[model samples]
Structures are given as C-alpha cells and as structure tokens.
Target: MGEENLLPNKQIVLKNYLQGCPKETDFELRTTKVSTEIPHGSKGVLLKNLYLACDPYICHLMRPRGLSILSSHGFIVPGSVVRGYGVAKVIKSGYEELKEGEYVWGITSWEDFSWNFYPQQLLIKINITHDVPLSYYAGILGMSGLAAYVGWNEICCPKQGEIVYVSSGAGGVGHLVGQFAKMMGCYVVGSASTNQKVDLLKTELGFDDAFNYKQGDLRSKLNKYFPKGIDIYFDNVGGEMLDEVMLKMNINGRIAASGMISQYNLKEPQGIHNLFSLIEKRLSVRGFMVLDYKEKYPEYAEWAVKKLQEKKLVYVEDVITGLENVVSAFVGIYHGLNIGKRIVVVAEE
Candidate 1:
C-alpha cells in the first residue's frame, strides 16, 4: 500500500503502573500511521474502532505486572496502547468469517485503529438486525449487560418477590441488575453516591427504592428500605457497604460479588467483617468473572435486544464524544461523576 492510503491512528497509552486513584495524567496520547489494507498471509483483522467502554477492572489491570494475576495477563504494558472492550468496524480481514464493513465488539486496544490477531476468541460479530444503537454494544448489549445477566440470573437464581439490593446500582452493570430483578417481579433497591443517580434508579430504571450511599447512615438506609432483609445483593462497591449489607441479609440469601470499585485503587483493600453472617445466615456469596460465561452472551444479547425494542428495558450512557477526552471521562467514574455506563465515542459509524 502507498503512504497516501495510511491513516493517522491515535492511541491512549499507560505512562506507568498505577499507585492510588487514577488520574488523566496517568495516560498519554500519541499518534501513529496505519494502513487500511490487510497484508498478504495475515490471519488478523484491521479494525476501525467506534466506541470504547471505561470499566472499573481496567484500574486493576494497570497495577504492576506481578501485583495480581489480572495485571499479569499482559493487558497493560507501559508505552503501549491500553487494551479494553470496544466496538469496531472491520476495515480489512483475513478471516473468512469476518467480512470487511462488518461490525464487532470485543477486546481491542484504545486506539482509532487496532489489529486483532485472535478474532475467534476476542471478537464477536455484531448482529445489528434491530434498531439498537451501536453504542449499546459497547455497554448494555456487551460485557456490562452480560455481567449483570450471569451474575443475577445464573449466580443469584432470583425468584419473584425476592428483595434485592444493588450497590452502585446506577452503574454499568448495577443498573441492569436492578432492571432484571424488577422484570422478575422482585423488589429491588439500589445505592449510588449521588442523588441524581438515586433518582435515576427509582424514576428511570424502575427500582423499588434507591438511596445515596453518601447520605446519612448506611445501615439505617438499609433498614428503612429492606425491613424484611435482603434476599439478593448485587455488590459492585465493596468495602464498608458490603460489611453493612451482610448484617441485613435474609437467610439463604445470595450475594453476587461483582466489581469492587471502591477497593480497586486502594493500597490495602478494606476488610469485610461480616463473614460470620454468611455462615450464620446460610448466605451464598460467589465471585464471578464474566468471561467464564461467554457462551451465554448470545442468549443474553437476544433477551436484551427484545426488551430494548419493546421499551421494557432502558439503558443510560454517559458518552464523551472524542478520544482526546477519554482520560477525563475515565477518571470521572471513580469520583462518581458518571450516572450510567461511561463510554467514549472514538468515531461515528
């Protein structure tokens, strides 16, 4: 290919391993040239990235390589593009299954263009047979949605009339969990850090009740909302909240341990003092990685799409339009600035 055909690819790279809470200064943006053509004999796909999702786990992966198993996965190498889930269009492909011009969602670098060598495992061809927004693939119809689905429907095995509580309930996964519980006829209550998010949960997301964790006493809030005790707890924020929720859990209740956003940036994670409650109340607390349930994506995607079409499910997104502002958008999530799924629009389809 000629130099004229090359495009300027912008990338956001990690400057160093994170220590405490992440800031925009932790990342650097640079540009490189890339071709739109796939080289001969290559088995990879060249992608035009459209949307990128800012997830809490990305902070964990930013730790030094040996600090944890997740960081050791080669996800964050200093001076290289940060890798995360995104929606992209195939510009050139060597795989027969993925055609040029098709859209996909999966693991891709934080760049305007990315080259994926393992499309079979890392990428799923997006089936846009409905009028669903493509940005939804970056969140609700993608990993976030899948995480909520597996954690609630499979892990919790919720039943109608169950009283459920979701921490960070207006977040990427938490909001969906609340909606799913409501769909099952369960009484759902959620906790966020802001009154706006609390209002979003009760008014927009259909939660039975919602509270701001930053408000008065957490235990008192729990008592007022769940006087009967919580049957299911979808925990997204760990720390003192988890400790308090355990004390009010119903017997034989289930707890889905999702992301611990509160502890991800801490030098030492906060300890939970309620393990005895698990044994005493016979509660089931399970920690799950969404990738383990990859096979269920199709099933979950179908259900979400149907609900979205029927207006039975609502998805909210905090969208930043340019990749240049991605760092600010990402850092905002930790401080509870985002009301829903935080995503950056790299390019418009």
Candidate 2:
C-alpha cells in the first residue's frame, strides 16, 4: 500500500465464544489495515482509538448464545474483532458531522484504527470548550456515567436521611452511584470485595460508610452499620450480595439493577432466596441499559461537568496503558482489582 493510502491496524480478536472467566488465551492480537481516506461520496470516517472501556457486559456478551448476558444486542460472534467502547480521534472523514482532528466516543473496537461508517449516529463529538479529559468520555462521561445518572434520577431517587447501599461500590458504575446518592443528601454505604476498594469508597469517593463483602459476618456487619435498614440498593454485583441486601431492605425500598459481575461467567447462575421480601416490603426494582436512558445524557453531561468544576463530583479510574494489558485488566474487574473505572489506553490522545 502507498504511504498515503492506508495505515496498519492492531486488533484484539476473539477466537471462540468465551466460557467461564475470560483468559488471555481467549483473545489474540492481529494486525490489519484501515484506509487512510474514505472512498469518494461515502459517509465514513477513519479513527485512531485513544481509550477503551473494559466492562462486565462485554464479558457477558462473549458467552455461548444460550448463556449470553444481554437484554439487547451485545454479543460478539467468534472470529470478529471484539467490540468495545472507546474515544477516538478522526483521521479522515467524508461525513458532514465528523472532521479530521475532532474527537468522538461511542461504539469502537479494541483496535488501533476504525473505519466508522455511521459516525454521525454512532459518535458524539467531544466538546472542544470543555476541559474534561478524552479518557473520561469512555467512562465517567460515557455510558457508565449516564447509567449512574439514570440509576439515581430515574430508578432510585434517595431522600435526605435515607440509607443507600451499593454492591460493587468501587466499580465504574457503582462508585458513581454511591457518590450520586451522597449528593442527594442520603447516607451512602458501599460493599466491595477488597479492603483497598472499601477504603477507596469511604475516603476517596465520599461514601458515608463502606465494607468488604468478602470479610467475616457480612450480615452482622450490614446490621451493625445500616441498623435502620437500607432504603435503596444500587446493585452491580449480584448473586449472594443481592440476596443479603434483599433481606435487609426497608419497607418501600428500591433496587436499581445494573449488572451481575459475580454471576456473568457461571455455568449456572445463583438464585436469590428472598423473593418474599419484595412482596412484603412493597419494594420497587428497576433495570435499565444505558440506551434506555439516553434522554438524560445531555442533562447528565451538563450536571456532571458543573459538579466537576465545583469540586462536588469525583471521577475515579484505573487506567492501564497498552492493548496488551486489556485482557488482564478486564479479567481483573471480576477479581476486584480496579478501584474505579477500568480503561485501556490503546493510543495517546
């Protein structure tokens, strides 16, 4: 290929449908190429990826079809490039809405370059006027942030003096949910699997209280800390945590169902033992995907930026450099190794 015609691309590909927890061997790095220019009259743009998100949903989608974890289109067929969310810089474009040098974030691949055919619909341009980092667009300002906003504003609106609890409290979405609960003047508590993440929730993210779920006497600890009972539960890690939370929910409590990282890879998912409590407490549980709440993005983006400027919002991320670390980083999320959002830096902004 001529120097002006194309560029080399490095892509992460799935060799087969994933089973159990994803391993480094489940994926392979392959080299390809992307066109340096969109064909004449085509509404396409070429992009160089900056940041990529490692979310549990991606892990769920990699499973065998019957075991696929999704309520919508989110699966990865074997032999295709693994799809992910990322921030990218435009290199060439024929789309009126996209221009060279502008940044965008949305559905991207775990690759160095992307030939985006629907940039106008699939991409949102980064605000040149804002001081927010490009990486945040893949997380705190992207689907994860929007999800937290919806979980609080639409799903579970906590009131002053009410008790709020979050499972997976230090994850990409859970940490933000806990913080948003605090912003609403509620008493917030979070449950993480490690003491390091527990400390992060209590100190860095401003949760009123936090605990390690893997520790001794979980029921006793939840009782001692949330003596009055939990009013709202933002669920991220499901399975046994949800069971315990259900048993401790106060009357009229709400549960914002996000994901079940603990149950994603299981051949057989665990069942909650306390369904009777839902009826007895008259509780409300709402589950939603990011796209289900797209109407709130503008409002959330504006509110989040204002909070960031006023020093009221804290955005935490465990950013790893290089695509080589993507597998370990993604697998680490299930092992509770990240303190906040897990991002892979495929390239510099």
Candidate 3:
C-alpha cells in the first residue's frame, strides 16, 4: 500500500447488561483505530458506516433484561461493540462480489468504521440504481421493509374489502404494513400511542381509520370501528392489544404476528388470556422472522421501490443526526416517540 490507512473509529459499546429499558448511559462512545486494509487471504470488508437503523428488537439483546425476544441468541458483549442493521460504504474488501466503494446495508456495528467479517449474505450490497436517498437502504429499503412485506403480504394475505388492523400503527414496520394492506384493497385501521401519529396514519398514510390506542378502551374502540370482527390483524405491539383483537376477530381471520414491542422490555412477558378465541374463531396466527426471507429480498425490494416511486406507497422516518445519538434513538422506539422508521445518521459516506 502506498499510504497508511489508519483512521479513528468511534463506536458505541455496551456499558453492561442493560438492567431495564435502555438509556444513553447504558452505552458509551469509544474510539478505536481502523486500518482500511483487507487482511491478506482473509475475506472481510472495511466499511464507512453512514446510517444506523434503530428498532425495538435491538433492545432485546441487552442481557440484564427479560424474556428471550429471539430464541437462542446470546446477550451482547458488554465492553464490545454492538451490531444492528445499517447503511455502509465499502472502503476495502477481500470478498469477490463486493468491490470497494459499493454501498451496502445489513448487520453492522454501532461504529463510524466497521470491519465486517461475515459472509457476503450478511453484508449484502445495495442496488444503487434507484434514485432514492442512500439512507433509505438503512430503513424502508432494508430489513424493516422486508419485515413489513412478509408480515403484511406474505403472512396475512388480505382479501378485498377485508378489515385489517395494525398495532403500533406509527412504528417502523407497522406504518408500512398498514399501507401495503390498504393498497391491496383492504379496509385498514391502525392504533398509535399519540394523536399526532394517529392523524398521520389517516391523513398522510391513507389508512381507512386510526385512533390513539392510549386514549380509550381498546375493546370498545374496536367495537366502534369494526361493527363486524376484524378479518386480518397486523400485530406490532402484541400484549394487551393482541388480547383485545383476539376477541374482535372474525372466524378464519389471519393475524400476522410481527414483533411484540410491548413485551420486549419486561422480565416476564405478558400472556394472552383469550387464546381460546383462537380456537373458536379458527384464526391463523402466524409469525415471521425477516432473515428467513432473504432469498426473496431482491424481488421484494424492487416491488416496494416501484411502489414508492409511483406514489402508490408512502413512508415516514425519524432521523437523528450523529453517531453519538445512536443509543437514545434506539430507546425512543419503545416509548413510541418516533412516527416511523428511526434512523441514526452516523456519517456521510
């Protein structure tokens, strides 16, 4: 190499196993040196991370916490860098398919510079031909988009004029799920934690109905909105909301079991009392993990991008500037502070 490629990389390290809900203090920003060199005979890539996608699931890896949100995954190493989905630029790579300067989005560390040693599949490169912002790959064009697609279309196949309800209606995945359901000719309703989000759902996102779930009794609200039972339920906050929806589901209804953010922070996750309704209603409650659908990612991305381009679909994002704000941006999701996808812009590529 003609020049030395040492650079200071600022990263967020877990201070310790998070005891409860995560706080800014739970993570500490530390700087490390990165050499923009793909080690001899090693298959790894050096990345200049531009954006970090923050979501409720990232909070589950903290060990000082509750029920296993994702089974068998070990806790994050306290003094080590934590990883999540994000957008990055390849600074150097030994991998054949990934050339330097290519943009990619996948599981990346909470750092300004990340050395990804995983397979090309985990560090999948983005298709840069789209005219959208590069940061879009960190969110609507990333895993969140796939999750919304699989849960909304793949799992809960909606029929024209069927009723669909989504919890956490203003959330990263929930927001898009509602839109996709509506596009398919389904009459969709969403539940948000605040009035502002509820309004956006009805006005901007084109949901047929939206209500502040915190403002009124859920059961009564469902009765008011759906005189008949719901035909499809896209569950994002799956605790009390799931229980209520169970009672208001039509026979043979479909419930797409997405993330249960309401239960992620609890040591003991809440149980649904009306599971018998699942039996009586003969409902099909299905859950999906986005990683399992990677093979179809290209197809889904193309279709979703076309939807956005043609103005058939719309999205919202809560972008916080600076890598230093990564921890706070993540914790904000559980509080329902973000209206849509929560993203942390770490640096410019």
Clashes of each: 0, 0, 0
Number of the top TM-score candidate: 1
Task: Count clashing pairs, candidate 3.
Answer: 0
Residues 50-83, candidate 1: write the lDDT tens digits. 9999988887678774244342235586787888
**Clash pairs (backbone) in predicted model 2:** none
lDDT, candidate 1, equals: 0.90
Candidate 1 runs further than 4 Å off: 66-73
Inter-residue clash pairs, candidate 1? none
Model 2 over residues 235-290: C-alpha lDDT tens digits? 98788888888888999999989878888888889999988999999999888777
Give the true-structure RMSD of model 3.
Answer: 2.0
lDDT of each: 0.90, 0.86, 0.86
What overall lDDT, based on C-alpha atoms, would model 3 receive against the true structure?
Answer: 0.86
- Point out where model 2 deviates above 4 Å: 1-3, 66-74
Relative to the unseen true structure, what is the C-alpha lDDT of residue 201 in candidate 1, on a scale of 0 to 100? 94
TM-score of each: 0.97, 0.96, 0.95
TM-score of 2: 0.96
